[model samples]
Target: LHNTSDYRVLLMDEDHDRMYVGTQDYIVSLDLHNINREPLIIHWPVSQQRRDDCVLSGKDQNGECANFICLIQPWNRTHLYVCGTGAYHPICSYVNRGRKAEDYIFHLEPGKVESGKGKCSYDPKLNSVSSLINRELYAGVYIDFMGTDAAIFRTMGPQTAMRTDQYNSRWLNDPEFIHAQLIPDSSERNDDKLYFFFREKASDSGSSAVYSRIGRICLNDDGGHCCLVNKWSTFLKARLICSVPGPDGIETHFDELHVKNPVIYAVFSSSGSVFKGSAVCVYSMTDIRTVFNGPFAHKEGPNYQWMPFTGKIPYPRPGTCPGGTFTPSMRSTKDYPDEVINFMRNHPTMYNSVYPVHKRPLVVRTNVNYEFTTITVDQVDAADGRYEVLFLGTDRGTVQKVIVLPKDEMEREELILEEVEVFKVSQQLYVGSTLGITQVTLHRCDVYGEACADCCLARDPYCAWDGKACSRYSASSKRRSRRQDVRHGNPIRQCRGYNSNANRKTMETEQYGVEGSSTFLECQPKSPQATIKWVLQREGSDRKKEIKSDERILRTDQGLLLRSLQLADGGIYQCTATENNFKHALVRVHLRVLNNETVNLVLTHSGLPMASLQGVGSPGTSRAPNPQYKDLLQLLSQPEMGVINQYCEGYWQRPANIEKQNLNKQQKDKPVREQRKPRNRRNHHTSWPQLPLLANHCQ
Candidate 1:
């Protein structure tokens, strides 16, 4: 249950329903269904002499000498390839699952230690990332013990092992590797490409500053033949930006970020030096691709000014996969001319900076002190709808679930559904070192629900709407007997015209307020996409004037606002919305305005002096009500404040001369009109044929 500070490496095997955990001096495999079950443990501690040497060298044995498995990956169908910071010496090995005995669950392939320096981090605190493709392992790690010689290396291939230009600040300036993946060409017309996401120091503007970057390399990039021998010829990186919208037209950048492809979700604080709070910004794949396709940066001859290269480019553009005229059989990076490789070495970083797809972040939590270390996505089926739930793991052993909903054309709604406590530890060791999540796996939908609606709505790639229900067809017998294609199954087809419930159109509500008190008349639309309109039906008149926000009226996202109440304000207010330009929704409010004589008595009982309540205005004021009112008047305006003197004052003071009208049947078929600008009329008297004149009496 507790890995403490060493939850840095994890690998999940879905076929076996098992998750491998790599920690200090051990690698354990736990049951995916129940983590509480007995785990298969393998002791991978360092040798005694190595531990002694680590301690003698003034390093803590518990911290540095332990064999912490930094990388645990599947080699093939029957074996797992593993590597660790072998007591600062670094080692690699393979675990043969076929050779396992009844007593021992694991057996290592016997061989002398191979170089793991490039495969793992020397200091467990330093970051490292690796990916396996075509029997080759591509890694980003520090090559020296000083933690300065960083490089991107490709090994375990028939061609000579290659790496980035070493000790070159232009290529990699103090990079902290985060993630690596091999992306195959979707059209299968180009060579496979490898990508790396990290944050590194930049020297673009003659100054050093940290910036997030996305770098890419080709699979067939065997070291350059001429000037750049044994080094990558196609390495290139671009800057990434996820900043808060500034108030004074300034751009407040958040350089620290974490990327999960399709959507690169980043956590940015107030600044890099301070952790005032954190914001989660989401960038789409299109934004990242746009920056990659932008013009590359080039250095001028004399002034050394970095500018976008606009001259005629050479054959086989830098950082591009072999394709078209540039095929693998035709020529690899190894055969590239010296002029091409030399240009790439000088201009590894791009000129154009990448920005987030949305103007704002999907989720921006300002007060959270804990930094986010990783993110994993899951498609969840709920009663309301399908949600792309973000399972964000923090360095403080807390995981948060986030959902992004669309609000408007340029805005999004970020909902933090819940926060789960993963560990019971009272104290944490480091700021961002303890309880780091290495992997997160969401189970298949066959275990979710039996109802087809819930299952299909989940939209999980692992699930299919199998006519009868949403089921995991991949594991079902129907997959083999009927030859069902789970990947191509259409879940959305089963959910057409699936309206859970219809919206209520007509609503009745009541409000009470003092003559000079300000109040809010709420009439929010059920759907966020709907537009709201307010109409005022004046007392003792058959006219209903369309209301708009001006000096005395204010419009808000929630509802409409009336600056201050008066005798003329007493009327029936109609709030309506038209969604999809057809369906209508509305609510009616009967506002009751009290005179000074009635409010004065009500405030006397609420424990306020008569002089303090003078701001309620005179009994008969010719001018309009004041923009501000006293606290007592504001309190008496609220309907809930009626309890203060319910028995003595009869709560709401109603005009004894007014008469009520029964129009429930007429209000049922209320017609919705198209939205338009409210007409400017001095006499506040207008009639609509579609709207019937209902009684303006208040209860």
Candidate 2:
């Protein structure tokens, strides 16, 4: 159930009801339904000789002399191809599930070792990504011991391993790999292509800067002969820009991207400074495809400068996958002449870069110091439309749940739904010391409410709008007729008939605090585009008064904060939000204030005599009440209540209560000449007796 080592690589086998996990020097298989049960763990440590050699090479024994499992890919239904950093020397092996003995829980398939230098990393901290495509391993990694030879390679094939030119900055210049996936060719005429997303140093920008890129390589490519032997023949990369046009007319770009599907979300900081904050930008797959099909960049002679190639192209094109009459044997780069192979070798990068859809990010978070490490997307169905929920994991052991509202107007903005601290700590956690998020997975759609509208509106492929309730969908369900029209259908109309009540929900709450203390009231709108308004409703008055910010009442983030509470502040406060479409959401709070005299009178209702309560905490008495009761007595004796921090704005502490003895002494020491007669003392005492025991009682 628990592993001390970082567990990042995981594969779920729904057919076997098991989950496979890769960690430091070990691979574990656990039951998906009951992970508490003992898991089958395999110890795959590096050889003792290798560990010894790592330490001899001036590396720490505790850090570098251990195998950290990096990549785990399912080769087939019965086998897994796994690779690891083998004590600073990379190596890999295949794991078989069919070899388990009858009595043993696990037995690995015996296999020969293969060099994993380009499949994993020498340093565990470095980034490397690999995926199985067309029965071959497509990987982005550092190919040398010094990690200076970064390349995208297609390894483990019949002919020979092919990679980007070694030490070639034009191909990949100081890159940090994020992830890779094989997108099935929509045309179906061409072979599938593997796309890798990464952040690398940009050269053509005329300045030292990092840019996020999406690189693609054909699966049918074979090493070129004579011209660029043992190198990729159809590898190309393009820049991905996800930036916003700032108010100052400057474009802010997010340079680190995480790709999933139709959209690729990127995290960007204003600068290299850690405290500059970060933003999440989104780019569409359509935009990426468009950029790839645009102009191609070529290296000219002089300084070998990169410029758009305008010459006539060869048949089947330079980077096209082998297709139609062109079989692998006929169209492979090895079969091409030296002239064709040399041209492609010098032009691995595309001339045009991909820009984000609408040139803006779906979500932008500001004033956050922690950089995002990983991200996952979820969807929720609402009356308006499907909301794409983004869960971004940060370096500070926290996960931020955000949502991109479907454009209700001319503009759309990202909403910060919640910020969750995944790890608990009593003190501040330091950078690099915090546990990095290895993965984020959304389990299932069972969490959606049991309404057809709820499931259908979510627009999650895993869920469908079953007539009665929101539930998981099956491929050949006889109830397909019961499902509402989704594809090419309006979501709001499908759910509007049955779920109108939730769309019109209004929130009402009551807030109670002591007079002369602070109080906070909040109203949170689901959409960030909605403008907030606050109004006060006084007793016996129907006239509405708009609340204004002053020294006594200040507006804080998403709410209102009232400092130094007074009797006049007690009223029915209402908060209303108006969206661009004129749809309104409202929340009302009835706040009541209680003075010290009224609080003391309420305590007497608990059956304690007024005189006994007053003397309960007298000094130097053996029969004195408990110290806890003394604190309570002091609290009740205070002139006013402390301020309440509503809507989680910030913290507020109350001033200590004045001692009763000091108050009595000051009253006795007052000069008779200067003393004034107590005005309506009897009337004030009589009013306290009639005060309500609870603030809500008056409401």
Candidate 3:
């Protein structure tokens, strides 16, 4: 695990408590409960001849011409069908584990390797998706070595192999496959369909526009009789639109798709370089089906625009499977008329585009550096109701745990990682990257904090306040005793009896700042949703006034920054947070500004020679004090006089040659001075050198 690389694919078999990982030249099987334990590894490197041939064909020997395992699908109860870019040739073999979970025997089956032309991609960089249903492999992959022939193929089944129209841009044009799913349309087995989600170059558009697509084909479709033999007779694809409305009737499109099924959660990103953005859109199966059933797009002539076809529809619609509920009379697509087959070929794309459930994205992030790469959703049954928690992975090696509350409010917490390739099974998330694989728990309820307000303000559906501590919420637990408000997160209303320190006095810390120097009052709010405000009460005053930010006084998310500290800035500053109409004081700082004269007096009394303090109050002098004198002055300004005296005594006790060496190095590194015009004495005060306070150094 430490030395191996390219750990990009992960397949979990929860029933057997094993996770299979695919990497370069190896397929690894690890224990679900403990990954660090000895894992079963199978070496599946490419043959020397194949590697030589790949290199001869202009592929990198170390990178491209390698056995990079990219696919691992369950072939049966105890066997896995694995495929790899076999030195650019693309080969697959079956991996055999024991029949039962207790049997730990795992190995690659010998003499079963086969050519994977249609099952896997030739290039490891190209994306592909596949789903095994009824022992047949339905894949969205490139069929050629050059990767120009992108197609959705059905192979490794009893029936004749079927695929999309070869070399037809209308079917697939530079497609980048995202995901594949086998969804049952009815109780009948033959009615089941295989759906492929991808993004491809738009065929109808003249420009280089890409569009996300949802393409589906009937599972039972064999071939056509006369027009399209050995090709799919029920292939239909629809545009998947995930966009946000902009000004002047313009819409911003998110064309790149990373999709998951079953209440489909698709992460889409804008392809435009100027406005980088990502969005999460949720789609229902009903809406996808409706779009597929709508009118088909057609072109009237060579240069005609794409529009809805008004021609008479063929019997047993072009996308319908044989012997399904709608068309029980036909037993095979070969029995359909030539008109139906030709129409299906000419109009594989639908007219209407499929929109998300709410016609908008659940989460939108614009002008961000990273794009969403993968997503997985887990529905949790909390005390109130069920909430869908989305774990969205980003290209920047992070995962965002997001939840949408009632009234369309959303909250998110980010989990950092080295890299991200996420696969979730049960309560564990298996993340794969080039470094290695990592297993993480679904919920860490204890990290929210101990206070009731802290727990409630988190608004995480997986955690709640159980009177004593913040812990994982269970539906069976007594709801009346627990405190959780994910919808509104009104901590004041929900934590009335839990906040015992509501009336406790706020603690104030003494902070010193030098006059004409800058210092920050640090105060971080516990909750990101809370609004921070600062108030100042002058010394010996009874009234407190709200502090407004100006050029010198800036309020940041962390705290308030007081620049060029003045005597008026010396006051008790209080940091407050307001959330859900509930206000609480977070921190208080009693700032005391030290003038230049006080600093000079402190330095003079610290046993420093008068020569070191000669230019302390003067400005624009060519003969300045040594730089080490400034370090001594900074140390002497601290209240810990005993430590300062100890350090000074030790400094002077160093060898005299070492002190001379230090002085020589300082003078050697100093920059040469340039002549400048003299300033009028009346226009500027003598710029005294200010020593930074110990508190500022700590901050």
Candidate 4:
């Protein structure tokens, strides 16, 4: 059985965990829970030689009859409807759901071609059977004496038999089964319209890949008696892709499909292989939704924004394929998608965050995509319904922790303010980003800093954390975050702030105009003080608030003299205050430096133009070494958008009449590291859709 060819089928009595399986050479009953794959075999009374002697007109003579089902789905606590895929596929025995070995019911009477021989028994079963919600069984299999093409068969349990005043339909005098699927309606249920899916092909046998056509064989309310000459006609034939996305973002594939639950989450791969970076997509209630943070590669602009509606846009729209907006890099102008540019210029929604599945995943071309190495959501604590902490899996296989506070905790900008907080959190989303899985939990979501423990899961299910052991908390009872009475290990204690250069205990600001220019207004702290405190821990709408004259509002080397100051002092000012020996103090101050706004411009043609050193003549042509650049540099050069970055040591835009040395360098260049791309690659080719399945009777 291990080396050559020995197959078997096992039917587990859902109630008692008893199982029965039939293979090419044998049939058996098993204790599935105590699995050793090697099942206990039950020998048949007939021998191999005698099998050939019997022939049924319903099927081919020499072929094995055991090709269908040998296991049974219990119709009740006591009975099972069983059969095999063999020529003599019969309602052989009904076993007690509790103990199969002791309760053998009855086998059907077999029919044969030549009077002396019995029915052919090749495989234990000749068809596949699935159960309905209430213990009734539906099978699609071939009947030897009937035909090579299979039909449908329906059998019910004791309760259903008495309730419907019936147990099974018939084929002539014998009850019949239809080999069709019972399709669930998308809407409006009608007991009269039961549908089924099937598989058929042009070839007869020996197939490498079976291209099957799924069809719906529908039955009317009065279809009860059509069993004798049962024939399933085609309905809607289709093929499901092999792979899909798991809840955790990994690509998962399907090896088989069953009637009980029919949904798929898989990816379309590059080489028809799995795990080659095949991002999984989920299909539920019909429409396909790709999981994970990626959109269509071609659709992302130089900025790589995720636009969920790219596919909905006109094909080859100004920003799409053939559209001028498809720049390989955000800095490149090569065939820049003017359509998308124009669309973006005209519609504000173009910049809104509407993530498309495969097309432009970015809703805007400016916000940098969040680089996730590993992002997991777990109930690291159970005290409350808080899943704020996110475990990020980096490419180096290093684990980074990040905590994302709910809207109730901070403003929406606070969420975006995180550069490294994307690193730490308490809840765990157990999936590696590099692992290439697509897991999305849809629980709840909002923009406010409110607690999202109870209500947030609906928006993003993955964010739901059951913290039975990690933290002491509870989910919000309603759609709102539950306000917790101050308790131990609360959010306040969970969130901590840190900055490395502890020795630099000072506050600084920007000055106005040239040196020795007009002074400005701002405050700065000096000397050693461990921490700079913010006057208001939570900032809100109004600017001013009531304050008492007593508390040490500001402390500094100059001793907190918050009055007139120099122009260079217009920036972030800090004051030192220590709490429990921790040099931590609350800070509250604002600074403004005056400066004339200026604009900078960087002209980009295919290449640099050649002309006089000072533009004395027409510029000659040469490919610009660096045409792709960030817009910030151009803004810094142009005097229009705003004044130059005050912190930088360089001037704003260069004067047009400047000398060679001043005009010959990149205006703004910063040192930033490079990132890695997905190692696994997959492509799901979805046309606006014209598939071969349309060739069937679907028309």
lDDT of 2 by residue, 1-699 (tens): 233366677777666666677777888776666554677888888888999999999887876678888888878767788888998999998877543322334546676678896788888778789988656788888877777888887777565788888878878889999888777556554567888888888876466788888888877777677767778887878988777687999776767665655567666555554425566667777877777777788767787677788987665566667652344446565777666677677767788888766677666766756777667676644333455777777777777766555555446645554465655521111111123222223324455445544455344444566666655655456764334433322345555555554335557766665544455677665434456889999877898899989966887556788755566778898887653323333678787755546645654443334553432212222232322232232233333433111201121122224334534554576465124421101001111222212211211
Q: Write the per-residue lDDT of candidate 3 for residues 93-175, one digit (tens) a residue.
A: 99998888799979999899999989889998887788887788988888898989988888897988989999889888999
How many clashes (backbone N, Cα, C below 3 Å) per candidate? Answer: 0, 3, 0, 167
> Comparing 1 and 3 by lDDT, which wins?
3
TM-score against truth, every candidate: 0.61, 0.70, 0.87, 0.31
Candidate 1: tens digits of C-alpha lDDT, residues 1-699: 354357667777666766677777777776666655677777777889988987787777777777778888888866788888887877888876543223335556777457787788787777778987766888998877768899998888686688999888888888989889776545554556788988888766666667888888877777677778888888889987777777898766667767676556666554545435566777776776677767888878788888898886666677766543345454567666677788788878788887776676666665666877667776654333455767776767777666676667787755443455655421111112345433322433454334343444333434554544455444424432211222222223443433121123266777665665456777755334456888889878899898888876888887777654567888998886643333333678888778787765654554444554433445443233332232233344456656555533442354443222224433443342112212110111222122123122112
Better-scoring candidate (TM-score), 3 or 4 = 3
User: In what order do the candidates fall by TM-score, top score first?
Assistant: 3, 2, 1, 4
Best by TM-score: 3
TM-score of 3: 0.87
Q: Which parts of model 1 are misplaced by more than 4 Å?
A: 1-5, 98-104, 204-208, 301-305, 323-329, 381-386, 424-699
| Cα lDDT of model 4 by residue, 1-699, tens digit | 321122324454534544555544334555444433444554433444445544433434434433333444554556544444434544344433444444543232234212111112223333343444356444444444444434444444332111111211111112112123344543423222233332333221343332212223223211212221222211122333444446897644332222212342222222324223222222342332112111322234685443444444422232221211332233211233444433322221122211112321101111223222213333333234444333443334344333333343322111111122222322212221212212222222232122322112112223322221112233433423233311122223322221222223333432122111122223332212123343321223344333222422334333333222223334443444442233422233443322212111212111212221121111122112111122223233233322333312133244345423432332221222111211111112221222111001111
